[model samples]
Target: MRRAAWGFLTPFLALFALFFVLPLGYALVRSLYAVRRPGLGFGPASVEFAALRNYAAVLADPVFRSALGRIAVLGLVQIPVMLGLAAVLALLLDAGLARAVRWFRLGFFLPYGVPGVIAVLLWANLYVPQVFPLAWTDLLAPPYVLAAIGNIVTWEYVGYNTLILVTALQAVPRSLIEAAAADGAGPWRTAWSVKLPLLRPALVLTATFSIIGTLQLFSEPAVLRTITPAVSAGYTPNLHVYNTIFTDDLPHLGAAQAVLLAAVTFALSIAFLRVTRRWSAA
Candidate 1:
């Protein structure tokens, strides 16, 4: 029976090892080397081991630092706004506020179902200052660009997060809500004191996913860049890597940046898990 089960799993394991692990290993190896073209006549110059040089170079670069800072600011503003809206929407949906709760739920999540590029294109049209005369003058300003991109992310993701929160809220027993109401607790009080605590796991999960997504944010910004000049080639870490690998023709440096980005993401994920675990235990 064990051997039979192993046989069933073998193909999946083999494919995963070949595609995922091998590519990751290759990227790591590539990150350690620089392709050096010594002779000029299209001859092979060979790969030189860079050790920590590429990492140091990437770390020392101001653009990389700025990109990271931009992403940090975007995440700080985006996640809270998105998740807060999601929580409120979830609460409203769960509180049986409207007869069309199912429609509203589907409507909200529908944006996420849209293709990202198409969504950006649609938003890009409305983002025009002329669309809203009051906001016309400030539409394409530098300060508004980050928020524009953030709004795109929020609009795309809030409903999905809401679904997660709502699902978690659904798991809370009706008896608990009834008991709280019997004790003279208001709806808001019940949500704050009773529901939010139990939904903590879902909240943490959504936050973590949002954090990871924010770190690697690219498509919306890339699409928006065509409309807004404020988003440079290296506006975010992932953008930086994309530019380095494809635009600048420096795949090795891009690989190094990718490795560093992964490390940073892993560290932040670990920190998030630790903090949430402590909060849950307490």
Candidate 2:
């Protein structure tokens, strides 16, 4: 039976190894090397093992540090706000608000169906003073661009998260809800005492996704970069890596930064899962 199971999984395992493991291994190997040019850039460039020099340089970079700080703040503010909105919407839908659950769900989820680049472009117009008469130009400024990007992310994913929560709510045993009602729990009390707790796993899932998405934020800012000076080539870590590869002509350095970012993201995800596990256990 175990051999049969392995046979059944072989194709997927092979594909995973080919697509995910192989590329990751290649990137890791590339990140340890630096391209060295001869004096006056006259000879063939050679790849030299850089050890941790590339990583050290990336960490010491002020732009990269600022990008990290910016995303951290964005995640802190955006994740809660997005999840809160999603939870409320899910609760309302589950409660059969106005008896139009299907329509409401579709309406809420419509933004997520829109292509991310198009959504960013649409929002960029609203932020760019030259394009819209009522534009909030201040929000497009350097100091507030992070928040603006957060708002865009929240808008895009809130509905998707709402759907996840709603599905979780749907899976709650009907008898538990009936018992709550029999014990004199009103809608609000039932939702507070029963439904919310049941939805914890869904909440954690959405939060984890939001954390990963926030760290990997790229498209929205990339789209906005052309329209506003607020977003520079190195506005985000992903953007920094992109600029290093394309604009600065340092693919090895860019690969190192990309690897470092992935490492940080992995560490954060592990920490979050550990905390959530403890919380759930308690």
Candidate 3:
């Protein structure tokens, strides 16, 4: 039986090792080395094992630190707002808005189907004063650009999270809802007492996804850079990594920063899951 199970998993294991493990190992190895150019940049570049120097440089960079702080603020604000809207929409659908449910669901999810870059371009037009004349170009300025990006992200993913919550709501036992109704419970009471509790797992799932997505914010700001001076090349951690590798030609430093970002993301996700689990238990 064990042999049969191994046979069934062998192909998947091989692909996982080939794709995930190999690339990660390469990045880790590359991140430990730094490029050295001798004699006023006239000599051949050499690779030197630099230990934690790349990580130290990435941590010391003001641009990278500012970008990290920006996204941290964005996730704190945007995740709650996005998830709240999604929960409301899901509850509305589950509340038996039968006739319009299909149309509403499709409309809400349509943005998710649009390619992210295209969506950013479409939104940029609305934000650019010359294009839309809404006089909202101020929203794309320094103090508000993070919020603008947050708005774009919320619009794109709210529907996706709604669908996830709605699926969880549907899996809820109808008998439980009927019993609540028999007890003279109102819709709000039933949702608060029955549905919301049942929706906890789905909420955690969506929240985790939102956290990861917010941390990896790249496309919208990258696209918006062309239209606004507010967005720097290092507008997000992912953007900073991209700029380091391509724009600055510091692949080792970029790799180190990327690895550190991944570590932070992983730690946060685990912490969130632990907190949610404890809350659910309580």
Q: Where does candidate 1 have its weakest 10-residue lDDT segment?
A: 132-141
RMSD of 2: 1.7
Candidate 2 residues 85-113, lDDT tens each?
99999998998764778888998899999
**lDDT for model 2, on a 0 to 1 scale?**
0.89
TM-score of 3: 0.94
Clashing pairs in 2: none
Ranking by TM-score: 2, 3, 1
Cα-based lDDT at residue 68, candidate 1: 92
Candidate 1 C-alpha lDDT tens digits along 1-282: 999999999999999999867877887899999988766837777889999888998999899999999999999889999999999999889989867999999998999999899988887777777776546665456878888889888999999999999999999999999999999999899989999888888989999999999999999888877878888999999989999999999899898998888888889988999998997788
lDDT score of residue 226 within candidate 2: 89
Top-scoring candidate (lDDT): 3
* Candidate 3, 26-65: lDDT as tens digits: 8889999999989998889999999999999988999999
Worst 10 residues of 2 by lDDT: 130-139
Provide the TM-score for each candidate, comma-separated.
Answer: 0.91, 0.94, 0.94
Residue 133 Cα positional deviation in candidate 1, in Å, after optimal superposition? 2.9
Ranked by TM-score, the better of candidates 1 and 2 is 2
Candidate 3 Cα misplacement greater than 4 A, ranges? 1-15, 129-137
